[model samples]
Structures are given as structure tokens and as C-alpha cells.
Target: MREVKGFNMTQTINVVDAMCGAGKTSWAIQHINENIGQNRKLAFGDSGEPMKYIYVTPFLNEVERIRQATDIDFFEPEVKGTKIKSFKALITLGKSVATTHELFKKLDLDILDAIEEKGYTLIMDEVASVLEQYDISKSDIKLLIDNGTIEIGENDKVIWLDDDYKGKFSDMKILAESDNLILQNGIAMFWTMNTRAFEAFDEVYVLTYMFDGQTQCKYYEANDIKFKKYSVEKSGDHYELIDYDPTIEPRKETYEKLNIYVDDESNKKKSPLNSNYDSREKLTNQQRSSQLSSTWFRKTATPRDLKQLNNNLRNYFRQVQPTENEYIFWTTISDFAPTLKNPKCKWNKSNDRTSDNFVALNARATNSYGNCTSMAYVYNRFINPMERNFFREYGIEVDQDKLAVSDLIQFLFRGCIRNDEPMNCYIPAERMRSLLKDWSEFKI
Candidate 1:
């Protein structure tokens, strides 16, 4: 590890290039371990906590291979009894532990697309072959090609040719193609065995086969060092030596700080204390108890939670108070009650506007739930729809009796106050205007 300050800028892609036996995968793994492990010291509390490597490969086989090589299992069940780190386990870790967050879900198609786009290290194997295969699939290939060159971007091009060809013409094609792309500042690739391709490569290698003797391998640069030797041995009667050079080094220092942990499968037993949330009804009960014990429910509360609770309450007030139908319901119930001491309510109405009694009742109903004139109107129209939608979207169940105006206000205005952390919830006076508009709509 050099005394480097660190690569202050984030790397979008780190390419570890090497042909066959250059140990690219091993080098890449070493790099990842070093960088991630180093990063552990720097990763402290923040909005988004640091996670161990979220290894993403193309297929399950590669995923499993990486997991085994790293001594990490990525496919264990998340139940308490499970010892392995499964996809389910990773998510559970995010939910329960403070240090962890989330693992990307492959099921999330959006994330899959993002992985292909803005990913850090693609960790591609046989990358040139992959690219070649991709180019051959016309359906997957670029929808457009410009002249003899396929324009990769507004200014870049990709050039390809047959591997077996060996003539001055092909050599000229390689030079022209390389120079043309280089002129446009583009990337290019050429097949092996064509030493004419050496014109385009930064480094070169020489491979030799031997009988009853050692094989010779040398790496060299065109203008700098000529060659350095490496050995090759054979298992069968026929032997071939494949050499590639400039010996692509892994992005070691960067990934050394990155420590990805792969644990053996866990097989723990589930316990009563950590039972899963069974149903929406159970979750509601849990939430109610949690809120009831929290300081927000107290008369003298901390400014933050109290403010949030009040804001939640205000939201409920804005969403659920009475309209004309409700006022009519209230009056009808009050009038139609069986007893005078405790008058129950009736809400039956036919939308008749002739008599002004119902109109007066509707008008006066604005002050039913709070001091503000429009509180009642805001409560009925706005809060109801929002609550229903939120529950439907998140699969949460609400208990109306246990719910308070402040709690509801906090819930409704949470998104507004999210970025405004360390601040108390403060309702604006102008909200009453919207409430009034809601009230006017309910006039019968």
C-alpha cells in the first residue's frame, strides 16, 4: 500500500485487463479486498451508511463462484435460524441492523438496468469475446452504422475484422482502422496471432514451445524494454504457448480498502421474540403500542417529536373534518338520537339545497374539530384520501381510534420535513386557505 491520499474521485469503471493466465480475476479480487478493507475506517455514520461489496455478476454461477472464492455465501435464507447469507438475509440485515442497509434486488428491473449503466467495476471475463459476441447479434447491435465504420458515439467509432487474414492489405486496414479511431479518440480491439495487430498494442509478448526443454515467454514494449522471459510447460503430447503482455495489473489499491464479507450459511432457529409481523392488524397494534409509549404522546414533549406529532395531527385535521354531507350527518344524528343527554349521530342526506338549515349547519361545521374555521373541511377531504392511498401503497393498516391529529399530521407532512432535519414542524397560516377552498366545495 503506497502512502497515497486516495483516489479522491470515485471510479465509475476499473478495468483489469490480461490475457489467459495473467491472473486477472485473482488480481481483481485482491484489489477489491484491499480497497474495501481500507474504506472501513472512513465509513462512519452518514445519511447512507457504507456497505460491504454488493457483488453483482451476470449469472448465478458466477455469483456462486465469487461467493465461494471469497468465502462468502450469498444465497442463504434470512430466518433467524439460517447461518448463510442469502438474498433474504441481506435484506433482513438492512432492516434490523444499524450498520447495514440494503442489497440490490435483481428482481428490480430498474436496478438491473442501472447495474449495466452506472456500475463501478464491471468485472468482465473474456471481455473482448463478450463484446464480439454482442456485436454479432444484429438485434442487440447498434441500430445504426455509418459508412464502413460503426459510430459508437457522436465522435467515436468501433472497427472489427476477420482474425485469420494476413496481408499488407489487412495490415493497412488495421493501421487505418486504428489510426482512424485513434484520430477520433475511440477504442479498438484485434484478434490474437496477428502480429500486425502489434502496431496498435502498447506492449507485446513472444511465446515459444520446446521439446525436452523449457518454454520461453517474454514481455516487451515497442520502443522501451525489448523482452522479459516466462516459462510454459505441457501436460499432453501437443503443446501451445499463449502469451500476452503489458501484464494488466488489477485496480489493487482502490479495491484493497473494499472488504466484502461472505459468511458461511446460517441455520439458526426462529424465536418468539423475533417473530415476523404477521398481518396488517398486528402491525397496527404494534404501531399503536409503540406510539403510546413514545414521548410524542406526552403532554410535555420534545420539540422535534412533538412538532412532528402536531404536524401529523394537523394533516389529519386538514383531511378528515366534516363537509356538508358530514354536517348533515352530524345534525341528523344529533336530532335523530334516541336520548337527549347523549345524542348519537345520523348521516342520511339526499343533497337537497332548498332549506337553508342544512346549509347553515354545513357552514358552522368548519369549527367542529379545532379552533381554525377550515380545520374540519381539511380533515374530511384531504386526510381520508391520503391515508387510504398510503395504506394501499405500503400495505400498512391504520387504527383510527389510536391515531391522533398530531400523529396523522406528522405522517402526512413527513416528506416535507425530511430534508428539513433538526428543525421542528411549523404549520403555515396559509394552509387554512386551502382548507377553506375544501370547505366551499362541500356547500349543499
Candidate 2:
């Protein structure tokens, strides 16, 4: 975890790269540890708020470097301050939110299906290699693969769940998704598969081993980031990269790890569970002329018919239903009319003032009457302020109150309006601004 000078430029995202046996894992562990330690208090080591840091790498074995370095349990740390999470855990969190919110449904389905389809063979191969290396029996390997529950697939590979891969067709889909597999290959094949998997990752670290028994490390942001070698010795507290000997064996496993794999091997395009595909269906045809006639058209109004209907509605309002009260309300609320009184001279409680209906009617008559004016007032005075806050929160550059309420409602609920659900924090701008100002210490 040697801190590189001037490396703390916090971009919203970054990539770190080094070759295998380089100090990428070491750097990650140290960065996380320092961040946690800086934020911690004495004794129980409370960091106040959980710092979100996600370390994504290919293979669960890569997880070991950081896990061992940080002295934390696999996926569960007893000594807690900062949360150290794998990319899979982060994806799961996002997936859970997506399910509840429907925000990431398509992405989740695509990724999940891909992993479920291919994750099995990879797991089986890895487990077989681990078992053979550790002198475990085939039955013992099977038991461990079935029961102990180790995640063995590469990153970005769809994760396999026990239920999704059961029965005959499952193994077929798995074979389709993965290459043909043979069990005799050892760690080398698994390593190659892992390398391919790791390449899919958003970031990677590359390292080089030298003839003098020293290793060099360089950071690559991603696969796109140029890979470079280093001759420097220091990495962090664990193993010295310059002194590292890959032949010395970093670690070895004895008992086979329990892992999960898909069960079936056939590809079956299953349809919706409750739908009856063989059921008879019928369509009825009626006369086109009759359908276009007055009675038929009235019964089944098309867009043209709907437009006529709306025009008829507006005409009805013009003739009969347009209420004068809306005009009065709009004018009064908008303060758009000339009848507004000077507060000092026209105090209602004064003797010179008159309680006059004539004055009120005259005031109402001073402006036009209709629902449109009242609706405009409702939108401009009431809705627009709330909408401005909405626009600010959403990072939208344009005013969106021109959008229909149903559209806005969908946006709010779908998280397009804000990353957090709009229902939880929607506020009128004036009120929110006042509260924010009054708080004095609030920022953003």
C-alpha cells in the first residue's frame, strides 16, 4: 500500500493496473485502510458514516490479496470501520435497487442471464483444478462444489444461482454459453480463463517479474491504459515486490472449496409459464363503411374523432360551462389586475372601506374568465416553483413544467428526476430555500 505521490486526484472513476504479482491489490488494501483509519475514532473505530469503496477484480482469488492484507474476513469483516466490498457485492446492491425501482431491469436481466448461462463450466473447471491440486476426491469435489458455496466465476460473468440451473436443459445452456471443457487441465487453463474474465473488468493492474528475483509494478487505468514495467522495490507492508518469488508459492489450498454450478445441459426456449400457446384464437371483421359511419365512429373514436371531441368540449366551455369564478381566482392570485389595493389606505377594518359585492364583481370583470387562465395561475404560481427544484435536483438544464404531470410523475418515480426517489424529498423551491437559508449551517 505504498502511496504514490500526487495520486489522490479524485476523479469520479479511475483505473489501476499492474501485472500479476505487482502491488495492485496491495495498493488497494492500503488505500482503503488509510481512508478508513483517517476517518476512525479511538477504541471501537467508528468512521461515523460508511465510506463507499468498491474493489472489483476477476476471480475470488484476487479478493484474497486485499482480504488478507486488510485482515478482514471473506465478505464479512469483524473489525469494521470502512466497508470493503467486491464488485459483485456492489452489483448486487445496484440490482436489488433496480428490481425494487425498475431502473436497471434490462441491464440486470442481460448480465444475470449471461452469467447464469456460462458461470457453471468455469466454476467446475476451477473447482476441479483446486481439488486435483489439493489431492481431493471427485466425490469430495462434487460435495464441496454443491455445498460449501464458493463463487468461482470471472468478473462480468453472470453469477449462477442454485435454482436457475437445475434439471436437464440448464447444462445445455451452460455449454452453449461457455466453450467445450475438459477436466485434465490444471491452474494454467483456469488462469487463462480468469485473465480473459479480468480483461472485461473496468480496471486492472499489471506487474512484471525480473531475473534478479525482483518484481516491477506499473499502474494501468484499464485495458486501454498503457501497460508499463517498473524496477522500484517498495509496494506496501505485505510482500516486497522486488523480492517476490512466484516459484515460492504465494499460498496453497488443501480441502476443496464448495462451489455452485448450473445443473442442466440442454437449451430449451421456455415460454411464459401460464400462457397457453396452443389455445385457439379468433379475429372478427366488420364492414369498413359501417365502422366509419356516425354511430360506429361514436362507439370507437379514433384520433381524428378524439380531436373533434376535444374541440366540442372547448366549444361547450365557450358557450355554457366556462365559470367566471376561475377568472376571479386567477386574477386575485396572479395580482395581474389593476384593482389591487394599497395596503396603507385600503385597510378593510377602516371606517372608509366598504364591504361591496359590486366592487368584487367589477374586479372580477376587469380580467378575462375561463379555466385556462386559472390553470395557468395554478401552474405558474404553484407548480413552477416545485418544478424548478425538480430541475435543479435532476441536473436538467431546461424548465420541465411544460411537461405533462403524468410525464413528470413517471420521471420522478423512475429516478430520472433525481437519483433518490422524488416522492421522498420533493419540495417547493421557495419553502426549501427558506429552510435551507434558516438552517445557517447547511451546505448543498
Candidate 3:
């Protein structure tokens, strides 16, 4: 380990990128211990008081796991000299503390005050999840509220929302407000996860297990000495690595290629067939109807059928002298058929005539259309059915019916449009064309 003073800085950050079961947590503990030993002292706060080492994880289960492991190791007489303590114990003793990233959002003022007064190292486990939970934006809040997934209160505050929606929004708000305070206190942050969680950071260490089951570490720093290499070994639940060697070359082709697509214009490279396609071009009634139907299902319109429907819609709109009965019949079928595939007949009293749920349903339909672009990609990567199923498998109490509906709706909406306008009010001509293009390109 390098000198602690050399590594400790106001913006000191480190990311431990490794695969599951790669002993990242074990490696982090060992690294912290070595740094503490090298400094011959632990980190202190602005109050000049000794600060505690904090380990933050995404879940309570992880906190319990680390607590159990640390309790067993620290009690050994050989390791008794290490003055390690859990966040809970630290809080009870009125000392600096550690906690899960979720709990960090709900931390009381007193605990936060202590953290601001005393600098500490924050070891964040499952860094990817933490980043996702905390990366909240005002736009996300507005979307949830507008889509009826959440509701604001009289105080202009989010008082009632879906479980996941409420939690994510609250945590994002807290983290956004408090992160600067925590950082300004000169705390060091260590992140352990599979993916890079931040755009800017002080350093990053990648841990890879070779084919022979040996773990290799590659360190990247900001200054002139750009990289260093080391070999790591696991002893029980802890890890140890060889001294940094600048001469070591990275193993050739040892890294896995991730086929991740970014949702940015630059990354949305033009396909040869779509090179001339314009997202903003206005389409005729026939072209618009065909584009909208194309989003619903492939081969939805033969050229003949599309031309007939387009003509009917145009004639219905042109009927200024038509009876009220004829006007209602045509308009209702034109708007409702694409969504429910059933006409609003006079005999059906159960059918909703108002456009109360139209916007929401249209938003859902649009989302479903978008997801069909890459069904496999959306299903495996975006859906969380397994998480919900885990409760049922274990006989845990939950609103299974609600969960099922919510899950289905969420899956349908994944990567979908959130336009609040009802299909009856106006067809999203441009959006439909864009979705058609996306589906076409994906098929290609």
C-alpha cells in the first residue's frame, strides 16, 4: 500500500470493478486495513476527532452479512489490535458511523452532523445499485406524478406514491442535497461493484479472475504514473495482493466485451436503410394511420386496408353536415379500436365512454410498442419478475395481485413513450414513425 497521506484527499474516490464472487468486499477490507496501518492512524474529522471506517451497502441483508463476517474475524486475538467497529455500535457510542446507502438517505440530522464534523471513509458496496437509486432527476418525479404512479400532497410534497417510486424519489432527493456536504468534509469514498458508477473519479481498480482462477488487479490513477498491476489471493474470507509492479503487462484479451447500447444520439448510429428517414416529417392521414398500426404489430396493414381506413377517417372528419349520431360512432371507433380492438357499441353499458384513462392507456400502448423493438433485450435486462417471484416462492406476505399487475404494466412501459395526450385528441404521428423505424432497424 502507498502512504495513507498520499492517497487521502478531499475528492479521494476508488472503484473496485469485479465480477460476482470475486471477493471484492474482502479485498476492500484488506486494503482499508493496510492503509490505516501505513498511516499509523485512522481518518479524523474537522473536529480533530478520530473518525470511524464506514461500510455502506445497498441492502440490509448485505449489511448483516458483512457484520457477521467482521464479528467473527475481529474477535480473534491475533486481529484484536484492529480497532474496527460496526456502524450500529459506533452510533450507540456517539462516534462516527457507517450504514447502508438506503439508510444513509434517512439519516437523522444528528448523525449527519457527526459525519460533517468528522471525516471518514465510506465503503459503498453494490455501487451500481446505489448509483441507480440515487440518480434521481426532477423529470423522473414529474413523469411519475403525471402518469398517476405517484401523487403529490397539499404541501407540494410527495406523500403518496408506489412503493418503488416513493423510495427511489426520496433517496434521490436526499442524496442530491447531502452529497456536497459529505464530500466537502473530506471523506474518502470506496466503491465496490461490477460497473463504473460515476463519470469522474480519482482512481479505479479492476479485479479480474484469470482462466487459472488467479485474481489480477489493475490500478489506474490520475497522475503521470497511469497504471500498476498486482496479483491477489484469497485467504478464507479476506484477500491479499502482491506489491504493485509497474513492469507487469496486462493479460491480453482477458476482458469481456459488454454489448451495451447507450441511449444517446451519437450512439444511435444511422442504419443504411434509415439514413434518409426524418423523425420530424409530417405524414398524410394515410401515412400516419399506417405508421401507428405498424407500431402495434408487424403486418397489421396490407396496402389496401390502410388506404381504406385512411379514407374513412378523412371522410369522417370532413362530415360537417353529418348527424350527431354518425359523428359519435365514427370518432369513437377511430380512437378506441387501436387500443381495445373493440368498438363502443350502444348495447355495451360496461364500456367507458370518457377519455379519462385514454392518455394512460395510450402511454402504456406506446411503451409496449417500443419494447417490441427488442423484446428479448427488454425482458432479460429491464424486467424484475424474479425479484417479485422470490417473495411468492418463500411464502412471504405481499399483495401478489397488485404486484402482478404493476409488474406487467412496468414491463409494458419499459423504454415506452410517456406522452400524456390521448390518442382520441391527437395521434402521435412523429412518435409512431420513429417507433416504426426502430422496429424495422431492430428486425434488420
Q: Which of the numbered candidates is closest to the native, going by highest TM-score?
A: 3
Q: The CA-based lDDT of model 3 is what? A: 0.33
Candidate 3 segments exceeding 4 Å error: 1-10, 31-51, 71-98, 108-110, 128-238, 241-444
List the candidates' TM-scores in order. 0.21, 0.21, 0.31
Model 2, 236-305: lDDT tens digits are: 5653333333333211110011010111226553222111111223313432222222233334435554
In the order shown, what is each candidate's alpha-carbon RMSD? 30.9, 30.8, 20.2
lDDT for position 244 in model 2: 33
Candidate 1 lDDT over residue span 194-221, tens digit each: 1121221112222211100110011111
Model 3, range 281-345, lDDT digits (tens) per residue? Answer: 46566554334332322334344443443443333224322222222222122333343222221
Q: How much lDDT does each candidate structure score?
A: 0.27, 0.26, 0.33
- Give me the displacement of residue 158 in model 1, in angstroms: 22
TM-score of 3: 0.31
Query: What is the full ranking by TM-score, best candidate first?
Result: 3, 2, 1
